[model samples]
Target: MSYIPPHKRQTKGSPLLNPTPAPLFNMRSDFNKFRTWNIGYTDHTILKWFSVGLDDELRLSSLVSFQPLSPESFETKSGIQPLSLVSTHQGCNEGIKNELIETPWLLIAANVKKDLLLSFQHMKREMEEAVMAQVKPSVVARFGKILFYGSSSIGKDSLKLNSLTETTLRKMKGSFHTDVPPSYMDYVEDRVAENLGQEYVQGKELYYVKLSDKLRTKSIVSCKCTVAKDHNKIQLYKIELNRVRHMVADMSILGKSSDLRLFVNTKKIKMALSDEEINEIKDLIASAILDSEVPSGIRWPLDKRHSSGGRYVVNAIGHTTAKSL
Candidate 1:
């Protein structure tokens, strides 16, 4: 019928009488018989393929996901149906001359158990090392009496390799992007300035606390310093007056009389510190109680600062070997 000229044939119902056009790709029998029925070109999907003398084995791995056609109906309690994938491998004994062969790669891959285990162990060791590098070591070889180590945060702007130098740990921050500053220290008051004029109040005294969030994924090393912020860089030194935690802590008069007292951080505890365990620093106790408003308060020394490094010193009063200046 297609050999006839176009205009010469009947034009009236001829279009309807024409046979149905064949499809571009009419796959049959689950790729057992794959054929292109009509002229068309697809980008990556296979239309038809065959092998004559090729040696390479063909392994077709396709994801077959059966999504619910109707979400509202398929998920009903009464509509629950079992779904599974099972290959009977049955129709092979029909004497078709084409022998069925089991997948050879599956058995071959099972022999690689020893090498696979070794590779897994190697991966585990590397991962453990990376994670432990971010944690603070409980026992460091060189963190002795004096702190010689420092911590600095270097961001991705430089992409420098993180490392531990003679005096510093180069990276201790996190991996998230942020607009706010990482940390503020230039204007933060020092420990001494924050606890001044507090009359024997122990809990309000400033102390360094551990930074917990820096031990996480994408972290490099724990801070190697005694402090996260340097006190010498402080620009503001605001003096704040604090109140006593308890009547027991309001011991300015008692402290002035005795040379021993304990400065505990807890607000309340049943196990009170004894006089034997109390190790009082004269410079610290004087600074905490010094006040201009109260007449009974201790007046601070003229030349001495409110806070500074101190030592536990003792002088010989009557020892025969002692020499006087």
Candidate 2:
């Protein structure tokens, strides 16, 4: 019997949707010849012997003993058919050998375990320290300047002066002169006239005063005054009555109230690994692992030998603690 490719199998259903039956092989003679070679036999050869469809009880017994029964003994088993085993075994062996040749690396880095772990920890710590050194000084300088200045102007042009509204001016006057003496109103009037080139008049109750320029074209300024009841003195000492727009709008209300707080945030700097650096590290670790010999009893499957080595190295490095370096 000749070997049939899965696509060329005589099956009515689709091979993908309904899998074709396992290939049969006349392994009775080959099994006797290679029965003693089980120690060195690969999984591919063992699987072919299994696909011969031996009885469940006999298959289990043979697997346990790691031996193939005689061809005459298989004659008693119903529906036991033998086909070409030599060609299938040769194909399986060629594939297995090619896999072994391609993946000359170990599945696990058992030899360089300590060295790899130490190197990873050292690399992580060095990277963290370098990043902190680069970022800490800039962050500290910016935050310190903000805290020390507390929104003070560094130069004259930095401060802007804006006009105050009549309603806001009235409120300022009321708050400042609420507890001042009647004589304080006279002093305020003199100051207003001297500074603004205006004349101030006292009202009947002295609770508020109206002021106009010398030409009296229109009222230029208004004043409100009151006498203090507790101290019987004036409390209108520093009255500028001007509100300006802030340079930093976010921190505008910082000093307006005693209990108000302003929070300043620094932009976060992201630490990223570039493709070049990632590839460099992977190659470095792969070289280290391949330089060491693989231990016995460790099976280097095709997948592990080819690409999984790099993945394992990355995962191992990531698991280490930078602080513990």
Candidate 3:
């Protein structure tokens, strides 16, 4: 028995990507400028106020908030304190003013100090609200544009890289079929000729336009093949079947060395059968043909369009045979 290696058959057609990732961020300027400003300014202030209360009210430690510095610092920097617990309503009272000064200890012991913390919290919240007011739209707009509409056309560099990658892949895949044995290659070539109703010739391989309903319901040119044994003596066949149906009511069979393949256009076959079951039936029926046990009714209908009598239309092949109940 001669060895038949696994033949790498090259399909002479283009294939598309499984899932195409869409582009994000269309505009360069807007995408870059977005989120440049900090929206956490108010959050920072609130954190500082909490820090202050931890030290002053809770007496947790002597650490003053390094940020949002004390009212005294505000007076020194801006020529005024943000809030005054002391009033100069009395006439030129230096001693009273000195006593009321908002030292760290005074703020800690004040009865209304909780109110001051609450006011500080409210102010921090308001500042945060203001900062986010400016930042939210820019951020929202960036995501909205990306989700609703893809980025503008890709750059030239990216397009060129994709093209190069596709071309290289095709070249690599093309090299695979170049090593297939001539006998195996001939098998595929003959099937193509038989499907197209043309005589099988040497050198030139025949190709058929396969029609599938599910994968787009379109036709694709494919290499046809018949049953052939591998080196392990395992019978193998490659035939294109319609996507919509299970059993093939219509097909074009191509034979090789007494091995015939029933190309079932299962579109008309309403019944279902596993590949193993289908193969078993085909082998059994073909064996019965060799033994002459199959009924005379089992015949290929003549093609009315191509021949005078019409084509061979068998209800079932292999194991599953159709019979009137």
Candidate 4:
């Protein structure tokens, strides 16, 4: 590998220390700056109240939490000793203060100490809530946005001392352009020489996609395709069949490949066939793939259960093919 000099080297930035790493989405700033030597805070400010571990009661990272430094909130944020026990209170005023502190919570926050009461009459929903209910639903989307939203690649390997994704690397791979070439038009013309085909191609022209010198040598042009109008109408018929069910019925599993999708669900298929034999049989189902749409090529008709016909967005290539492919 070539050397990357001092000025060219990308240095690491501090992580955005999530004060409450609980759901992560509940907080935002993505760089950590708390531990580095540049700050107005002292270790005692954090260490004196928080246990160096979790210790969320004193929300430190956000700098904008409501009643942030109070332990006597939400019936006390937690039972950690750093926050004093409320039983030490001395009057009706103290009870009033405690009630005011707990006003925000719908229910009391669970704690190591409070849970030991073992009162069968009580339940903490946050702790004992159904697994499905307490799940952090938005975390996956948030994480994808932070680390991979702008990433690009042809394949997924990289070893050039790059940490962040480089879109330039994808441009380096080969030309990926939308321009339709003249030969591509001819190719498309050859496939559909009918009246409707001529009408579709009558004014449609191809544009050459310019490319970088490294990728210009690749044969990147290919015919673009779309669902033909008549085929599209057939698809509409298929949708109509589903909506007005009494008019059309799906063949029995023993008779044809029902719209059921799993390739392994070979109910109507002959059981003795091997993978090569299956691919060979499926090959008999001539398909003009919408390369722009079905970027992941064809791998269907795993058995001899459906008939073939018509032009097909192929959202579920299984449709139209319940009777035809």
| Per-candidate local distance difference test | 0.21, 0.23, 0.24, 0.21
| lDDT (10s digit) by residue, model 2, range 1-325 | 9897633443233221221121222222243332321012212122111111112212222221111224442321233221111111223344433222222122112222332333233333333544422221111101110011101222322211222122221121000001223364556576855687776443322222122223223212122233334433211111111111100101101111111111111211223534653453333323322111342112223343322223221111101111110
Give me candidate 4's TM-score against the actual structure. Answer: 0.13
> Residue 8 of model 4: what lDDT?
34
TM-score of each: 0.14, 0.14, 0.13, 0.13
Model 4: CA > 4 A from native: 5-225, 232-300, 303-325
Error of 3 at 135 (Å): 50
TM-score result, candidate 2 = 0.14
Deviation (Å) of 325 in candidate 4: 33
lDDT of 3 by residue, 1-84 (tens): 666432222222422112111111112122222211111121111111111112222221121111122443222222321221
In every candidate, how many clashes are there? 0, 4, 12, 7
Pick by TM-score: which candidate is best?
1
Candidate 2 yields a Cα-based lDDT of 0.23
Weakest 10 consecutive residues of candidate 3 by summed lDDT: 138-147
Position 83, candidate 3: lDDT: 20
lDDT of 1 by residue, 226-317 (tens): 11143221111121111111000000010011111111111111133234322322233333322336432223345432224332211100
Off by over 4 Å in 1: 1-83, 88-122, 127-325
List clashing residue pairs in candidate 4.
14-32, 15-31, 15-32, 16-31, 16-32, 17-32, 321-324
lDDT of 4 by residue, 39-67 (tens): 11211111101111112323222111111
